[model samples]
Target: MKLGILFSGQGAQKAGMGADLYAALPAYRETIDQASAILGYDLQAVANDEAKITQTAYAQPAILAMSNAIINALGDVLPTPVAGLGLSLGEYSALTASGVMDFNQAVAIIKDRGIYMQTVGEANPGKMVAVMGDDQALIESVLAALQAAGKRVYPANYNTFAQLVIGGVAADVDAAVEALTDAGIQRMVELPVSGAFHTPLLKDAALQLTTRLAGETFKATQYPVYSNTTGSVFTADTLFETLTKQIISPTYFAQALQKMLDDGVDTLIEVGPSDTLIKFAKKIAPKDVKRYAITDVDSFNAVRDLLLAEGKEA
Candidate 1:
């Protein structure tokens, strides 16, 4: 079975995500230490802080460092990843894993990206909500109605077959949620993000990031890295443009996974904290394919042993 690497995004982060890995593995410790030095703060300390970890500025780089450290620490035991895919901000980590960039470059830019997004968020003061347990057409109509009414709400992420992350101006988002609730929608849990990510409201952040991304050097990829904006393997030449557009466009994660599946990625492995991407993968992945996640020490050992065993057999 071919193995595909997955990276988790902002909301998937939690307190103490990579601390165990750092304590147990020298590689992890070095990787985290390297990232911390570049970031001008202790990466683990920032992630461990309850309040800091949730803030966009801290969370983005924290998750990137944690995820990249785990992948880097795994070394040759990982059996040469077949492809890489990440949710939103995780895409940068995926690129680092694929050799498009190094860990230091990724964390530095990711921190700046987060700060820029937060800046735009502060200026706009928007909101995002997960629209759950509703028909896709119905949800689309709801979003379309909001647009027609000039309320500014839109579907920011297409996470699963049924779940959508909606983003808009705070009051417009609130009004949209209220309307959906009154129209028999059962769930619309507001995300605790600082801005309306992956929506037009973040256009300023996207523009700022475009200039930042242009300065960074990117190498050719070792394997396919799917784009959240186009939901397919992105052109390396246009990488910066694709990533910039991703900030203001809806992330077609469901479609991205489908494209990976179509290309024969059978065993999906989540390389960061929590199973948020795994949960979304399960919703769209075929029943026959397998799924794994490497989060803490135990999970790391489990997937490591399995990969080592698979390696021995081959």
Candidate 2:
């Protein structure tokens, strides 16, 4: 049974995400403690407190901490030989799991990254909106009209054939939404994010992160890891440099999942707060592939049972 792990990005966080894992797994608590020491902030508090989870500075580390905690807890039951990929900010957690970056370094980098992005958001007001339903040509046409009108709008994420996200200046984003609505598009919800992530507006943060990443030590991965930047698998040799590039590059999560399928991955597992990635993957992956998400203790147990049942069937 070939397995793959997916990590969540910025918007997937919720309060008390890792509380169960921290209580059930000693290693998880230890990992959180180490992260708190490195970050000089209580990671557990951030996970349990909604106020802290909403702040970018705390959210990034908190999400990363939760992801690491889940993976570590799963370690007691699952092996570490699976392939992995993370979405946007989740890419840092993927690197840590893949052995490209140490846990503490990953935590520190995400903390700095969150702070930088928050600062950028304050300087330039922006917004992101998720557009659902399948109308690729229509969506493109709407975006083009917005751009032709001098609006700073662009497609930030191609989540699925049925889902896309656009980001840019607040006015431009609002205009894009209005245009899409006029075109009869429903389910256009503006995300709660403070900045236009994955777009050129984050260029400054990306550049700053590159410099900080260069100072960190990255080891070769023992397992295959996919790159959200290019939607391709990376070896131990190119992990660090590719991770640095992933900061500014748009995440090709859909493409990455396709690549994983092409590579013969049969079991897809998302290790984080939500099943968003697995949901996306199931929409696009081959019919024979199985999808699993380990978001909380219940989902974790469900996945274990599913895997065991599959084994018995085989």
TM-score of each: 0.96, 0.91
Q: Per-residue CA lDDT of candidate 1, range 118-172, in tens?
A: 8888998889999996486787888899899899999899998789999999899
Candidate 1 regions exceeding 4 Å error are none
| Tens digits of per-residue lDDT for model 2, 99-201 | 8788888898898989988887777778989899788679889999889988898888877777888888998888888899899997888888888887778
Screening candidate 2 with a backbone cut-off below 3 angstroms (N, C-alpha, C), the clashing residue pairs are: none
> Each candidate: what lDDT?
0.88, 0.81
Q: How accurate is candidate 1 locally (lDDT)?
A: 0.88
Error of 2 at 256 (Å): 0.9
Q: Candidate 2, 235: how far from true, in Å?
A: 5.0
At residue 121, candidate 2 shows an lDDT of 73
